[model samples]
Target chain A: MLAHYGYKDGSGDYFIIIDTDKCDGCGKCVEACAYGVMELIEDEFDIEDGSMAAVTEEHRKKIKYSCGPCKPISGERKLPCVLACSPKAISHSW
Target chain B: MITAGVDVGAKYVKVVLLEDGRKVLKRANGIVGFDILKSATEVFEKALLEAGLNHDRISRVTATGMGRKAIHKKHPLNAGEIVPEVIADAKGAYHLLPAVKTIIDVGAEEGRGVKVGEGGKVKDFVINERCAAGAGTFIETMARALEVGVEDMGPLALKATKAIPMNAQCCVFAESEVVTLIHSKVTKEDISKAIHDAMAGRIASMVLRIGVEKEVVLIGGVARNPGFLPPLKKELNTEITIPEHPQYVGAFGASLLAFETEGK
Candidate 1:
């Protein structure tokens, strides 16, 4: 089933990278990702996403949800949950 | 038997004097003070004088809400300040409406979802202290952004034939959207209605999450809005009872708690 969707390794060595320093944890990326691969984690940073950020299993840090198919509330480039981050803690490269 | 309740809210201080369990005198004032005890004392004294009753005639006193903790620690105050206040709010509503089971208190800065049981006791409650979406401030902010008086919002919203889609999910961002709509020359009535819809939508989402019971009572400052009722009542799909003195609900409930304390 995973192979049929054709998950590509994009731009980075890791499948996903989350900067815990920047995540706000509004959980939009988790809601957006169909694969259920990302989890919002609590980190002590206000500048990233204001409250919580998404962290992947691999622990690599990235910024915002770049998923093309996700429906953002504001039609924002980043999901409102990820855009809400002040520290820039969520990103998925693959 | 004169019992009193002082609801020191974020925007206003409401004091109520109940004479033999009926409201004899009530007052709401917007005062400035860092020391709540002074304000409480001032308001209490004012209510007492207005009712032509001295402090000695008053049986009990109760306090509720965010300022409760502060009032409890102040001079000549007791621990029963907060709990009785909540109980009184529920009790007062019970006296007016025998069938009331749920109380929605949307105040200036926060909102509360209260469920009342037999004998006017609060069964379970949820306080939305972390978010400002359900509070009066949300509408106030939207009113400012839309360039209309908050008091005029309900009537203006009622006149709206269509509602524009507001983009922001949060209160702060939503206010910005209202400002942008104004720049786009959207009708004020439509903007007002949109604001009402947004607020009602947010509160409705919360109410739906908790599962509202029949005979729900809507109270606090936001309950006064005519625009708020239609959408909220539609969402509730039940008859909502709004007391004549809604803003004083927490204070009224506190007074009832005082009566309960005295077993009167």
Candidate 2:
């Protein structure tokens, strides 16, 4: 399941897309995050006791603000999270 | 068919079981301590026990609230179908009063204003997760500062002879201000009113960002505060409607969705 966590309001789309198929529950993104936005959640089926990476509940409602600091003002918007993920499961929808 | 909705809120967990999507079987809630799933299951089991039913009797169980995401496979509550608390709150409030087009839900940790369209669908919402001053925790902290029960904060405010202005909106600063008020011999009642007024201002501003519509309803645990209601009503400049069980609205909405999502 490709879970998109974020809301679209009068502001443009701000989403942190997580591809569960590609994500192997690696905690790299969780470690790389400075804002504690990402968390490791256990999978529903308990397949091999694998977990999945998801945005924390507190940050979900306000993705733009939560993920804003990492997205720089003028520099190359090379986000630490997308760079940290080996499986390339995480992507931001600006 | 029986369906259940479990709401794992920030400060509390709630469970509501519904029969055939219309009739209610039980409502249970308790303080949500550490291990969010454990407390939720305890409350769920309590509701099950009260209803005289087994876990297997519930055909579908949908989970909602701040801690809804915390429900993983290890959860013994058989929680399924993760739904956002905003949606559940909207659905639940709309069910109770179909005319309610706007819902203001201020839980212990967060506050939100949900605009509802036809059939209780969420049209738009503004969530105040960035600030604790806009939530029930603000009063909870102030109540502790005043050395009064949280339940007494509201009623105590009602006795105030004059409205005392609270300078600090942040919970941290507000606590210090309460300490200062104590030193200055400020009555607890006036200070309580100041706390509630500041809290209401923050919440009402959030609702205003979405613009208030007619038939507004207030839900969540804070709705039970008799002192907080008047300030909120005055801030919104409108009459606020509250359900008999305001805190149960989220669970009620989730159960209604459980019934709706039974086959799908």
Q: Model 1 scores what on Cα lDDT?
A: 0.67
lDDT of 2 by residue, A1-94 (tens): 8899987744367789999999999789999999799999988745567799999876776566557556543345678889999999999988
Over B161-190, each residue of candidate 2 has an lDDT whose tens digit, in order, gives 888878665689889999999899999999
Best by TM-score: 2
Clash list (residue pairs), candidate 2: none
RMSD to native for every prediction? 11.3, 15.1
**Model 2 stretches astray by more than 4 angstroms:** A1-94, B72-75
Per DockQ, the best of the predicted structures is: 1
Regions of model 1 farther than 4 Å from truth = A1-94, B76-80, B84-86
C-alpha local distance difference test of each model = 0.67, 0.86
TM-score against truth, every candidate: 0.71, 0.74
Q: Which ten residues in a row have the lowest lDDT in candidate 1 chain B?
A: B77-86
Question: lDDT tens string, model 1, B1-264?
Answer: 767777878777777777666755655444527887677777777777777777787777777756666777466544245653346567768877888888888888877667778877788765555456557888898888877788999999999999676645557878778878888888999998888877776566555534578779988888999999887788667788899889888787777677667764
Candidate 1 local Cα displacement, residue A2, angstroms? 15
